[model samples]
Each structure stands twice: as structure tokens, then as C-alpha cells.
Target: MTMEIGLNLFSVFKELNEDYFGTLEKVAEMGYKNLELITVNFSTCERYTDTFSLPVIMKKFEDLGLKAFSAHEGVAPGSVIIDADWDRIIEENAELGCQSIVFPMAFISGREDTLQTAEHLNLIGKKCKEAGLSFYYHNHAHEFRRIGETSLFDLLAENTDPSLVKFELDLVWVMRGGYDPLTLLEKLGERCDMVHQKDLGMHVNPVNLFTATPQGTNLDTMKIYTEFVKPNDFVNLGTGIVNFQETYQKLRQLGYIRYAIVENEGQLGIKFTSIESDLKVMEKYVQGL
Candidate 1:
């Protein structure tokens, strides 16, 4: 069977104006089958949640036939976790019929603390598993930072129970970090469940992992022409550097038949035109897959 392709809702966060209604509707319009809810940037108290309590939003997803398979939330500010609404997210994800919950690392400090990150995920996974949910990290380039003998991904994967903790691999960031993307995929094994895919043409300047920028390049507004997504050069699917064909081949070889999320992380500004550009290009790709 062909692998499932999805859109990471982060892109919508920009152009949709943080309006949940517009975001959901636009996702359906784009013909996405999967969605990963993100930390809202709205000023509305209920909507601006790192702690989710959005049943109406979840219902809308179901109503529109968008399966919210995963979601992203922060390490409860100050605390390593959402001590208050932790149960709520688990139960709601179960309610919305989502399969996994994704926790994002906001800082290098958080990324470097391998033991704590693993323990946090392991603990959350155990709890969620009981509710028929799984816990995973959404990897960025930072997670690949090496301390001694292994990358943080290695330590967290090793420490977390294979049955519980999984991963949502972000491809551009992984490549930007200077590690072979396939190597991390291979090392991660079954822990791999989701992926962030975008292309970046060859970045001309020195690389910056945190900023996803290269020297000599104006990241705020990148003009595209080539197809060599360099380290830090993420763009819409066909408009940038990644070779989706080869990436898809590798994924098929390794049995990754789940969601391939287009994390068009607002590199410059939130523009729906980029998303439309992606959909137009990726539609052909997804159909072939």
C-alpha cells in the first residue's frame, strides 16, 4: 500500500490567522487526510492552549473527515510536562481518536538533557498507552546534537520503551544537522512513525541549524530557482531541494507506511501561496505513491 501523506498544521498557523475554523476548512480544501494540531497562537483564552481543551475543534476535524492522528504541545512552561492538563490531553486525544501525541523540544537545554527527555516521554507514553495512545518526539536538527558517543535521538530511543515512545521525524532539520537522514531513520527503527518533509535548494552560506539558514542567504524571503535543498534550505515540496522520489523509495524500503507531514514551518512569513504551491506539486507525487 502507498504511504499516507498529511499536512502539519503549523503552516496554517500563519496564514489562517490563528483562526481554527479557517485552518480546518483550508486543510479539508487541500485534501489532506491527516493533521497534527499545534500549540495555538490565538489570543482567545481557550484557543491559546499548550493545554488542550478543544472538543469543538476536534469534532470539526471529525466532521470534515480529517483524521487528527497526532498533535504537538510544549513541555509545560517551567515544568517538564503539563502537570495540570496532562490527563486532559490523553483523554481528549483518545476522544478525538488520535493515535499519538507529539512533544516538541523548545531549547538546546531541553534537547541536551537526554535522561530527562526520555523519562518525560516514557512516563507520558505509559500513561497514554493505557488510553490507547502513543507518545513521541517531533525531531528538529537540535535533537541530533552529540554529547559523547551518541546523539540525543540515540539516547532517548535507547532509554524509552520501544513499545511506547515513537518519533515524528523532521527530514529537513535532520539533513541540516549534517547526519544522513536515512541513518537516523535506520537507527530509529519502529520508533519512526511520522515525518516532516519539505525541500530546500542548495543554501549558499555557512549553515545555521537553529535558524535553518545559510550564509549569504536572506532566509526571511528566499527566492527559489534550483532544486538542491541545502542544509537549512527548506521550501515547499517541488520548489526547493529535497528529492522526494528517493526519499519515498527509502521510506517504502524501510516499511514507513504512515503519515508524511509537510511541515512548512513559517520560514519567512505565513503565506498560503506556499501551501498552495506545495499542494499543486505534491498532489502528483502523492497520487503516484
Candidate 2:
């Protein structure tokens, strides 16, 4: 199956907060038919939906010809987690016509934390399945921290149920973690249900994040590591070092992978122009596929 170009709303977060409908219209006009909605804040449970109800949101998406294909959820204060109103969250996402509910990120310190997170994910995934929606776990560079020769991500993969849980692999994070995304893709195969495409600028020193920063998974350590990742470290889709052609080809070969989502991060100042450039590059890649 040919993969479609999609956008993660986090790209234009500032614009969305300022003018929700206007930002979305611009996105649709730029040819993004599918979207991965950022429903909740990473640090807090403040939901964008709290400002607008489900029906209103659905109507807007329908009117614009945009599909809410996936959504990001997490454990924030008052946010949708395993303990907090998860059933309602699932019902609401289903009502919004979302195909999948994704747990965006986690802070893991060690093997136990990783395993526990995986167990919780299994529970969430089971619930999502019963509600007729797929569940996915999105990764950051922290998931690649070594634990007994194996990465935390590997441990999570081992602990989670294949039938219940899948992954939305972020290529930039995989590279930042000092691993080859293509090789990781080979290992993940069909379990990688989606991909977040971004590129590393040519000027990024050491290239691998783990190389310069110490391997620590705590929040403070993570923040310290983030400080090392400058805004310029990220470039538009095909302008940097990532191999988009191979990535698209690999996803097409996998046959089950769906959206190759455009994740325009670290370019907030020019989010509109960045995504437009990304779409041009993505179009070529998809055509090749």
C-alpha cells in the first residue's frame, strides 16, 4: 500500500492555540489529509479538547476534509492515563473518529520502570482494542538508554503484548539515541505501525545525542540532554541527513504500515513554511514508493 503524508499538530502548536480553525485550514490547503492530533500536554493534563467538545472538533475536521487518524495521550496531571478516566478517553477518541490512541512518551529510570510502563501500556492497549481502536507507544531518545546490554526500548518491546501494543517509531529519536533507524525498522517490522519523520541537520555535532550527554533517564537529566539538542539540530524533512527514500520504500515493503507522519519539530518560528517544504519532499518519496 502507498503511504500517505500526514502531520502531527504539534508542528503548529503556537498557531493552533492562537487560531485553531485557521491553522487547520492552512494544513488542509497544504495537502495534509491525515493528522495525529496532540490532545494533551506532555507535562500537564491540560487537554485541548477541554476548550472544544468532541462533536465540534469532529465537525471541523469533516468540514476541512482532514482525518483525525491518530491521537496522543499521556499521564499528566488530570490527563488521560490508566488510572484517570481512560474509558471515557477511549470513547471520546472513538467518537472523534480516531483509528488509534497513542501514549506519546514516558520517563523511565531503569528496567523496572520500563517493564512497569510496558505493563500499563498492555492494559491501555487491551482497552483500546475492546473499543475498536489500536493503541501505540511513541518513543523518545531516552528509550534507547542501555540496560544490561539491551536498550530500555527493547525491554519494553519484550514485555508488551504484540496483539495489544504497537509502536510509532520516531526516526530522529532513534538516530539521536545512537542507533540506525533503518536497522531498528528491520527489527520492528510490522510492529512499527507508524513513523514520525524528521531530519537531523548536517551541522549537529557528534550527531548521536547519547555520545555527548550522559545516559540518564530521569526528568532533570532528560532536560539537560534536551539543552544539548539545539533548534538548528533539526531541519526540514529532506534537507538534512535522514534517508527518506529508503524509509518510504521500507514502509511500503512492510505493507501494513500506514501513515508516514510529518513531525515538524524545533522549527516553531517558521512552522508553516517548514511543513510546506516537508510536503514537497514527502511527495517525491511517496511517488517513488
Index of the highest-TM-score prediction: 2
lDDT of each: 0.67, 0.82
Most accurate candidate by lDDT: 2
- Give the alpha carbon lDDT tens digit for every residue of 80-114 in model 1: 56363778778766777678888865343334466
- Please identify model 1 stretches exceeding 4 Å from their true place: 42-55, 76-78, 82-84, 106-112, 204-233, 267-270
Candidate 1 local distance difference test against the native: 0.67
Q: How far is each candidate from the true structure, as Cα RMSD in Å?
A: 5.8, 2.5
lDDT of 2 by residue, 1-289 (tens): 6577789998887778777788999999998899999876433446767878888889999999999989887775333346867898888889989999988888775888778889889999999999999999998887887767898999999999999999999988888877888788888888886899888887776355655666444434356456777777778888787777677777777777678888887654578999988888988887552
Q: Model 2 Cα displacement at 255 (Å)?
A: 2.6
lDDT of 1 at 84: 38
